[model samples]
Target: MRRLSGVTIDCAEPAVLAGFWSALLDRPVSAEHARPDWATVGSRFDPAPRLTFQRVPEPKRGKVRLHLDVEVDDIDEARARIEELGGRWTGERHDYPGEGVVLGMTDPEGHEFCVVQYF
Candidate 1:
């Protein structure tokens, strides 16, 4: 069986961007990693894969190709929490007759990800 360990994000500041994701996902960065170029957050407890942030010299351009779909208990509450942690809402929402709602958002580094609530 193939197992996925985590997802790596590319950004200009690893520590700063990692902070936003660490708080949002409720995972602490690994103490073992002392390198300033990389940071990681996540644990086996998390239902999804772990998150890793790597330092890059350039800022992101245009839109990201991959978007993470995060399932939340409450869309509005989750959105609020994201902003409180430094992320912002994209001001876009999609409704599916009986499916549920999806809210678009971006991380501090402008990586696109979605908050999903299924009814």
Candidate 2:
């Protein structure tokens, strides 16, 4: 059996990226696993994998294939909150009647993610 341990993100600033993700996920950054160049967040009763951030020297060149999908109760509120936290709405939205809505957004580090709300 394959046990999914964690997902590591290559970033320029570990603490900053970790902080953005931590607030968005409503979880605390794991101090024990954090370092000057690496930081971890999320892992409390959540069956999903944890998130780790590692410091990298190079900037992201192209688009990211793997990004996060954050589910929230309200898309508008979440968008506002994300914007308040330095993230921005990408002006792209998708709607599925009787299903849900997906709002595209970019994090402080320019990583794209989605805020989803299901009916």
Candidate 3:
């Protein structure tokens, strides 16, 4: 069986983007894996797959089709914290009576992600 390795994100600034993810995930950026054009957060020894960032010449142009969903204990708190980290709420929210709540947000660079809270 093949195991999923890690997810790599393309961004204009690898280290900066990695910093955002590192803080959000509470994972340290791997100094050993950092370079001028690349940066990584989390370690191979960790059970979760590491996140890597690669430098790209072009800026993000349209809406991202694939986005990350960050599960949190409190959606409002998480949204506020994300905004403190240079992210912003996108005014998109959904709620299910007994299921959960999902709020769309964007990173400093405008990458979209969701903050989810389940009841």
Give the alpha carbon lDDT tens digit for every residue of 12-38 in model 1.
888898788878877787743568898
Residue-pair clash count for candidate 1:
0
Models sorted by TM-score, best on top: 3, 2, 1
lDDT of 2 by residue, 1-119 (tens): 56776788988988988889889888888875747998988763457778888988999878899888999999999999999888999999999999999999998888888999999
How well does candidate 1 score on lDDT at residue 46?
A: 58
lDDT of each: 0.85, 0.87, 0.88
Scored by lDDT, the top model is 3
Q: Quote the RMSD, in angstroms, for model 2.
A: 1.7
Candidate 1 to native Cα RMSD, angstroms:
1.9
C-alpha-based local distance difference test score of model 3: 0.88
Q: Which stretches of candidate 1 lie over 4 Å from their true place?
A: 43-47
Q: How accurate locally is residue 110 in candidate 1, as Cα lDDT from 0 to 100? A: 85
The alpha-carbon deviation from the true structure for residue 101 of candidate 2, after best TM-score superposition, in angstroms, is 0.4
Q: Tally clashes: model 2.
A: 0
**Clash pairs detected, candidate 1:** none
Q: Give the TM-score of candidate 3.
A: 0.94
Clashing pairs in 3: none
The candidate 2 region of ten consecutive residues with least summed lDDT is 41-50
For candidate 2, the lDDT comes to: 0.87
